[model samples]
Target: MTPIIREARAGDRSALIRLMGALNDFETEIEENRADASAAAEHFAWVEGQIEAQGGVMLVAEAQGRVAGFICYTFEEDPGAFVRPEYRRHAMIWDISVDEASRGQGIGQLLLNAAETHAKASGIGEIRLYVLEGNARAQRIYREAGYRNYERLMSKRL
Candidate 1:
């Protein structure tokens, strides 16, 4: 069955948390960061904070009465302190994840499409996001969706 993608509602907190746990698990596996119970709690809190941040978009995909995935995005009036003024007022997709059981079912792409649509409707001309270096699967999806590589983020553990 095709999943329905819609804006996240107040009752979607639990499902959103579950989807984030899956995302955090995959991220922890590829990065040096630790993913413990506390980290999960922190992620939940962070998601909630973003949802509460006005003027942003929070969406979820539901199938068979269960949340299959979610996407969160926010507008950045100033892309960054260093970005030129012309590049400001862009939308950023902060997080997007689908449950493990729902992988390869087009849920991720649907979430992305929804995000782009929302951004355009909101009068935001550009959208951006960061993907983990090791997440080839997600990278492929993003590229296929017409996203181009623009910058790289380097980090050093000291």
Candidate 2:
């Protein structure tokens, strides 16, 4: 189903938080992670702060007068001096998720496009996000959106 993409409003906070919790649960199914629903709520303030402090965008997709999904993005500082100036302050898709009932209806893609529009308006030329290696569904969606896996983050039990 097509959704209305709009900037988040005060009334959307609760629904957005609920979606974040759902996102944590969904990601946990792909790979065991340290975060859960409670952690998602706990860290949401920091996410909000990052967006506000940095000229970012928080968008929600509404259908039938309810928030079906949301996406949050912000500009990230350059990682190093060696990075190219054009992409130094790249946009980061901090979070993106659609509620269970809203899945498989193209809501995610619309949210992504909205985020890209927001980034472009802010003079950003690149956007990046991380998805678990096992999240093949999200991987496919992102790849189809032209997001490439140009980097790898490796970790080991230490």
All candidates' TM-scores?
0.90, 0.94
- Over 79-136, each residue of candidate 1 has an lDDT whose tens digit, in order, gives 4578777777888888898998999999999999999999999888899999999989
Q: Give the C-alpha lDDT of model 2.
A: 0.88
Once superposed on the true structure, which residue ranges of model 1 sit more than 4 Å away at CA? 34-38, 79-86
Per-residue lDDT of 43-156 in model 2, one digit per residue for the tens? 677889998998788999999999999999888878777888776888888899899998989999999999998898888888999888888989999999999997899877
- Return the top candidate by lDDT: 2
**Residue 111 C-alpha lDDT in model 2:** 97
Candidate 2 — worst ten consecutive residues by lDDT sum?
Answer: 33-42
Off by over 4 Å in 2: none
C-alpha lDDT of candidate 1 relative to the true structure: 0.84
RMSD of each candidate relative to the true structure: 2.0, 1.3
Model 1: how large is the Cα RMSD against the reference?
2.0
